[model samples]
Target: MLLGYFSLFASGFIAATLLPASSEVLLLALAQQGYKPLWLWLAATCGNTLGSCVNWYLGKELLRFQHKRWFPISQAQLAKAEIQFNRYGSWSLLLAWLPIVGDPLTLVAGTLRVRFGLFLLLVTLGKGARYALLLFLARQLW
Candidate 1:
């Protein structure tokens, strides 16, 4: 029981990082094992949300190296992202829980200098809602 939540927290953390990890399967298995759903949901949500915060901080720090040759994104790409951000607005942060665009959205929010309070609020809401939905749906399957 203790091990399960710990593993889920680790998995959730890694998944939110640039690293490839997914806690969904482990979460589902544990749910079937009769662990309390609310506790499991909170574990995954908090861990994942904290992980996204790491990515957000990394994105914020990347601005320091924007002029360096080794910087990962090109000026053109950054400009394009800026254009998209301008059009889409910060509400796109809600999609931060999604894959592919989700992680990048969090990074972009940081690079764009989004307000930290708003960033945390949006990220928490999005991630928390996702876990809540998953818990709700998973329970129906049993």
Candidate 2:
């Protein structure tokens, strides 16, 4: 039982990162298997949020290498990204649950030096709501 929850947590964490993975499937499966929805939700949310934090940290670290010729992002591109991110600002974190764009948003949040408290709060709310909705749908359909 605990292992199932741990797997869900791990899936959620990995899914939130740049790595290609999906926690939604595991979450729905666990929910359908009669696991406690609340714990599942909490585990997934916390794990996913923490994974985003990892991206955030990486983004902060990435700036250090900007001066290197090996850096992938050009100064012009980084400047453009910074402008765009600033235009959307912290509110963008609410979409951190979204696929593709979500991971980058967290990374940009760190690059732009968004307050950590705000980042965590918005990320947790977005991810928790997503898991909650999945659990609700699972209960309703099965």
Candidate 3:
């Protein structure tokens, strides 16, 4: 049981990182194997949320690299991001469960200096809802 939870946590963490991975399958596998749903959900949610926090920290470090000539990001991109951040508002962090954009959203939240408390709240809600829904759907079919 401990091993199962650890696997989910590690997979969830990696999934939230730049690495190309998804914890969904492992989560479902555990569910089907009769693992406790609540523990599984919490493990995945916390791990994934922590992983996004890592992105947020990296975003905080942007000031150190933005000035370097080799920096991949340009000033125009930064400006555009600032504009979008204003347009979307921090509430957009609620969509942190989304696949293609979720990771970047977390990073942008930190880069734009969105309140950490709000970031954690929204990320946890989004991730928790996703896992809850996944488990619900699985139980429905089983």
Best by TM-score: 2
Candidate 2 lDDT, 1-142, residue by residue in tens: 9999999999999999999898999999888888999999988998999999999999988899999999999989889989988888899899999999999889988888888899999999999999999889889888
* Candidate 3 Cα errors over 4 Å, as ranges: none
Candidate 3 local Cα displacement, residue 89, angstroms: 0.7
Query: How well does model 1 score by local distance difference test?
Result: 0.87
Clashing pairs in 2: none
- Estimate the lDDT of model 3: 0.88
Cα-based lDDT at residue 34, candidate 2:
85
Better of 2 and 3 by lDDT: 2
Rank the models by TM-score, top first: 2, 3, 1
**Could you tell me the lDDT of residue 82 within candidate 2?**
90
Q: Write the per-residue lDDT of candidate 3 for residues 1-142, one digit (tens) a residue.
A: 8999999999999888767789999999999999999999999999999998887787778758888999988999988887987798988888887898899888888888888888899888998899999988998999
Provide TM-scores for the models: 0.95, 0.97, 0.96
User: Which residue pairs in candidate 3 have backbone atoms (N, alpha carbon, C) closer than 3 angstroms, thus clashing?
Assistant: none
Q: Give the TM-score of candidate 2.
A: 0.97
What's the C-alpha lDDT at position 136 in model 1? Answer: 88
